[model samples]
Target chain A: MAIYGVALLAGCMMFGLIIGDLLGQVLGIEANLGGVGIAMLLLIFVTNVIHQWGKLPDSTSSGITFWNAMYIPIVVAMAASQNVAAAFSGGLVSLLAGVLAVVLGLALVPVIAGKPEPEQDCQDEPATAVASNTAGSRRG
Target chain B: MFESLIELFDEYHLIAAFAVIGLTMYLSNWLSVRFTNGKFHGSAIAILLGLLLAYIGGVVTGGENGLADLTLFSGLGLMGGGMLRDLAIIATAYGVRFSEIRKAGVHGVVALFAGVIVSFLAGGIIAVGFGYTDPVDITTVGAGTVTYIVGPVTGSTLGASSEIIALSIAAGLVKSILVMIVTPMTSRIIGLDNPRSAMIFGGLIGTTSGVAAGLAATDARLVPYGAMTATFYTGLGILLAPTALFLMVRAIA
Candidate 1:
């Protein structure tokens, strides 16, 4: 039943929140840390386990999808609720915060990805080719 | 009759909210398909539209809750509250495919943490650049660059002001849209043509919808791989941002 999916989600959320609260206490932070994230992890693990058992019926999967589809509306609602006018008038901080995020994130992609395996075979030829080209250009 | 109709809308304001949002989505999606040819996702457009409406709502009412300040749209306050927002975020985990993650291997895993750290630090640095000295404000905005959800979640936890939280969300939304638009264009340059690369990309990018849509445009086959790691990225972001990352920011700033 679809309700089963919701029940599972709710259970995971509760468990995650409790654990998060405990973790917060241990860390001496007054706020809950990672409760929503922990809950999502629990749900993923639980759903995968159920799928492995072959007990995850279509009904249950659909149940999850039904709510998952609500992602768009929820996000839109959130945007609607945000006070961007106030944020904008506050300063250039928000715009800078966003622009820097994308630029810095894209710059680090190559650094994080390193070298792809298949490209290694062809790497030597391009390396020498580019090296010679650059050397010739510098001399000219 | 008019009074009764108004009463009905008030009583069923939640439903009214759904109707209004539904209409907005329809219009946004229509514009997306008709004009942008789906290069931009409908949801992104809808979000932009929502932000615009919110600005107008705030200007019209001079109140704090944006569109929720309006009597007709008051239900948006509850609909957009932390409860439903978290629920929507948690629901995303339900769609994850476990087998797909194994293909990305070690780099995929590393990318997830790296993506979160880099994105968090980028946000934090910019927060500092803007003269925000409080660790709570800095951390919250930094987390927002990770993902919109992470921003508000971290913000509320740290007791950041509403203005800061809103900025954090905006920062995230901008990052998400940029990823969605830029990924496809840079695919060839970055070698994002393969599933493994896509996974790594997702891990580095960290926004699920953005990575998913971006991968979808680049290569439909790679969506699952990219989205799988991206999903984990959000979870990891939530876990690290508020606790470890926040502490680091607190120490540094």
Candidate 2:
């Protein structure tokens, strides 16, 4: 678990750096700044997903915590070096694109097909409820 | 080494990058929670925001130095994350009870992966048609596309961070298109009614498509479509992941 956490954190950071550089060139932005942001976001998201999905054990939570803590500093460090004006301008474009995807995705998808059923609610509720109720009666 | 690191940051202008991306991911995640009813939808939002933040940061910082290096690294990172996420989910599902696994199951995983591959292939074809030949690699471009598109869209529509929000909405629009086209076919093949499957399927497809679009759009004008393609891929991935898995299992058995 510790290894996986480390791998995830380091991997995300490196990925951020590389992708940041590439995107910076492609879109005429800054590499380090992009790298840091990508790294932090990826690390947070990946770790959060593992936790949410119940894959990582409780003992490993600390590792994820450590990684999350590190993200702020790294990002801050990266940000300290950037051209604020350009960053904001490119950011504005990125921000606009990101917003459009989410809103349209949420609104349109549901309208067309409605939301997918929650997986948890679909199974085992009645049986578990019945079992608990019977146990309560016996205790009473 | 210290000097080099400091110089690198200074050259790149790291502070603005961090602020912009940090806020981008945060806002995107917040909007996702506000709008979506699904479990872990917030996490998805976070992931997208992170990617967007990274992409924008790279673009802003690279400036005259160019993004060649950052792009390569980001692509690799995205591929690694996608693979790790896939493996983790699959392994966890297998370890649990069969009944529990059935809820989302191996089929779902396979479908999602397959959808990603399919989307990538489709995107590559589109790229080829448009005269781009960067080798249709799914790892580097997949997640970035999703983040770039979805983060902006979700953030904007909710009146949060406009750039991130706009990206999120674009991603969603792209995903929706993919889902509308692919979900029914995948559903018929896998035999599941759950919309979650469709969502996963859509995501996979959208991610793949985003990469393809990015590669194809050598010019800046076409770059925006990268987010749209990813959104479409994701929507298809989420929707069809489960059904695709089921079909694969039956065929193998």
Candidate 3:
């Protein structure tokens, strides 16, 4: 049932947070080492397995979708509580950080974006003509 | 009875923060719907409000933790802790399908690396300019350009000062807001109409909130495509910022 999938999702989330905490402890970072992201990956893999074997119910899939949609809004809401105080009071140092980022980001745009068409090796300009010729030759 | 009620509020100040945040969300959404025509999502506005509230709380109380410094709002410290943040991020994965990520291909992958490295360098250079000679501070700021999430992680790992870490987060936040505001305006010039283009854009920009919001405004259909790579961008940034990137920065500056 869909309820089972939701329960499984909760379990995965809890498990991920624990692992993330443990990872942070080991890494000595004092943060949650991408715990949510790991959990999401786990859920994606588990759900796929469930779907592949013809076991996942529509209800469960919907439940997953519902939670997925809520994730962003919740994340955005949570981000408001971030340490803006530090950023604001950090003074000219932080100001330079944003300025430099924008300058460098704009400069790199040309090199890093939308050049895949040049890398396309094959040219299939006349797909219809080639297909028609092949068909006619075969029939003849 | 009134004194007891006040005590109860002091005990559950977190609930007050929640109430305030919830109301802030509603007001933000209404403002978005009315003025910007939903161009700016409620999430962004809510953040603004929350920050304003925190600033007010800090000014009023002259406390260290902003609203958390107030006895009636201490819950915010825990509520805004890593636990909920991590949980929310995990939920974001539910919507993602791995196959979609694969469709971005080699170019998207390249963009991810380029995005992170270039952003990091930009940030590091600024940190250096600001007299932050320490590698930890430089690397943290540099990583901040990659994404907000990477900044704190790198800072904590390298033992950067709290102020520098905050600066990094600010740097990332500014990048995200800029990307969000600029993406829709430049979408046509950037050819961000297709799924592939969106993927590359996401990779290059690497701020999930900004990418998603910008894409939503530009073309709702492309949000998922863009956010996928953006999410991966965060993961990669986290992996690289403290270890490989930190070493590279140390060698250079």
Candidate 4:
């Protein structure tokens, strides 16, 4: 399940990249390929943050912290190290455009994958209260 | 064809970095689950491991003048060193309730974007003050960009596994170098708290800006790789701020 989730997320990123590239070309913006990647990453990060924050789980928070502290820097470093001269000389814009297109192609996966609905709050309180009452009764 | 494949594998260090980071994270998580019963707090472990691996790999593959040479390693080391510096800054900021400076709702997002922008502007000013020219106008994807684009394209064009891996790794390393140089200064200037600062610093080194800046610095032969570092710092600010801001807004909303 975890592996599947990762693959799904990766697929979504690819799709998002594609959509972002097309959007960039339509808008005629430079570096839109990156823009798309940023957008996808942001979407994933924020959505995860929000979803997990709602749960207030320690594990999730730890995951978020790990991501913020470690993953972001790694991604930034990777992007920065490219040979910009060759990228430009070889029409990096178009190539990025193509990469973006590939990313966008994968966008449909999420729609089909179906995001889980946010958990309800009321489901747990009654059970907890009952358990506490039982413990109190036993103590009495 | 074989030579090209070998060269491609030798170049793109980002893939290797990613692999290292991923593996490190996996191992850390595995250890946490085993020892702490799933209570491992995130810290410098994974990043340090990734850096060590990249350094070792570079040394093994490129030898003395290879991508992991003295200058590049030192630059990367300095860049990583900044993370420790930011950890102190973050501790201080939290000590003073600095996170409260922004509205509670959007503080994290604001902090992240501000950090990136501040770092970029500061890094740029620093670069210009230090007499570094912007190597490639982002307005057009130039030679630098082509190496990344072409590396993948060439691999795909040639349909060779070695070429693909080499190009990816070369691309990654060059990117990492650039990010390392610029991100610390930018993050420091932006006044982000510890975790965000660390992440932004990492991100700056992770992208094409790192490679671009590194190569530009190398070409200009000014302070070895100063230009590349500056470019990575500034480019990150340019590239990431908007999305960060947007995410913050959404988070608050």
For residue B14, model 2's alpha carbon misses the true position, in angstroms, by 6.5
Candidate with the larger lDDT of 3 and 4? 3
Worst 10 residues of 4 chain B by lDDT: B219-228
TM-score of chain B of 2: 0.30
Q: Which prediction has more favorable DockQ, 1 or 4?
A: 1
Q: Tens digit of lDDT per residue, candidate 3, span A1-140?
A: 66676677788888866787787768655456545545766877787787789887778766665555554444333444444454455567555666566556544545555343432223323344324222322321
Provide the global lDDT of candidate 3 against the true structure: 0.66
lDDT of each: 0.72, 0.35, 0.66, 0.32
TM-score for the first chain in candidate 3 comes to 0.61
- Comparing only chain B with the true structure, the TM-scores of all models are 0.65, 0.30, 0.65, 0.29
Per-residue alpha-carbon lDDT of candidate 3 for residues B1-253, written as tens digits (9 for 90 to 100): 9788768877777677667567767898899899989877666566556556656666767654555666666766656555554444444455455644454557677877887888888888877876888888889989887787899988887898887777788788767656655666677776676656666777778777667556654655565556556656776788789999999888986
Predicted model with the maximum TM-score: 3
Of models 1 and 2, which has the larger lDDT?
Answer: 1
- For model 2, the docking class works out as incorrect
Maximum-lDDT candidate: 1
- In candidate 2, how many Å is residue B171 off? 13
Clashing pairs in 1: none
Query: Which CAPRI tier for candidate 3?
Result: incorrect
DockQ of each: 0.26, 0.07, 0.22, 0.04
**Candidate 3: how many backbone clashes?**
3
The list of candidate 4 runs beyond 4 A from truth reads A1-7, A30-140, B1-43, B63-117, B131-253
Off by over 4 Å in 3: A1-3, A14-35, A52-62, A102-140, B1-22, B39-44, B58-81, B95-97, B131-137, B144-202, B205-253
